[model samples]
Target: MKTGNKIKLFLVDDDAVFLKALQIQFMENDDFEVETFSTGELCIQNLNKKPDIVVLDYHLDGIVKNAINGMQTLDKIKETNAGIPVIMLSSQDKIEVAVSCMHHKAFDYVVKSETAFVRLQKVISNIFKYQKMEKELNWYMDRM
Candidate 1:
């Protein structure tokens, strides 16, 4: 996925307005190529596009009653490509929810708020930094 210069980002949320706003936020920056999906199923279907990161809504079934939720989506994504990073987004500020997301292998959990985008930016930055370090370490180990 890192083969491209710009990060490919998948934004999955049932809230049209919120999804559009978030898409606009990421699109304003040239660093990302953003793709928005209204449901987890749609996002999963398009996962073959190989997005570098996925920002998934915790309540993905808001529009479709039987649609898969964020946790399920995360698990499916991991099953398909464990290397892809998934950040779970939700209005739930509960510690348990965040912990559950972490347990389910979410790269991070973010609460939807005025400052959510700012926090997301920081989290994304950290993710890339960590990936870089990991890559470098692997390179060094390979030579040893």
Candidate 2:
């Protein structure tokens, strides 16, 4: 969780082109190791892979065949691992949607756009920084 360390990232999106593009963009950074999933189910199935973070889209096609949306997938993920950081990616700009995501314990939400990748990198970096600090703080407290 140190800065510049290789952080495993699992990215879930229904858009094939966007998934591939993001995989490439994230992999270009030495600090990131990216895996792309075209569906939330696929990502969930591979949750044992222990990715440091998950980037998930807010919408998906064919998920649950008829019932589930990305938010439901997010809920499932949190159910399985509440501490894992999740960053929601969506084109939706409504404040309610963002607030709902936060209420559900998402680490952050980003509107999908040309600059989304850049913003994602920054967010991940901050996550790592915070995690590192938390570890240090816990160690200090344990020694007290």
Best by TM-score: 1
Please provide, for model 2 over 8-101, each residue's C-alpha lDDT reduced to its tens digit, 9 standing for 90 to 100. Answer: 8999988788889999998887777888887888888899988889999988774346635678879999999997899999989999999999
Error of 2 at 10 (Å): 0.5
Misplaced by over 4 Å in model 1 are 1-4
The backbone clash count of each candidate, in order, is 0, 0
> Which clashing pairs does model 1 show?
none
Tally clashes: model 2.
0
Backbone clashes in model 2, listed as residue pairs: none
Let me know the TM-score candidate 1 reaches against the reference structure: 0.95
Best by lDDT: 1
RMSD, each candidate, Å? 1.7, 1.9
Candidate 1, residues 26-121, lDDT tens digits: the string is 999889999999998999999999999999999898899999999999999999999999999999999999999999999999999999999889
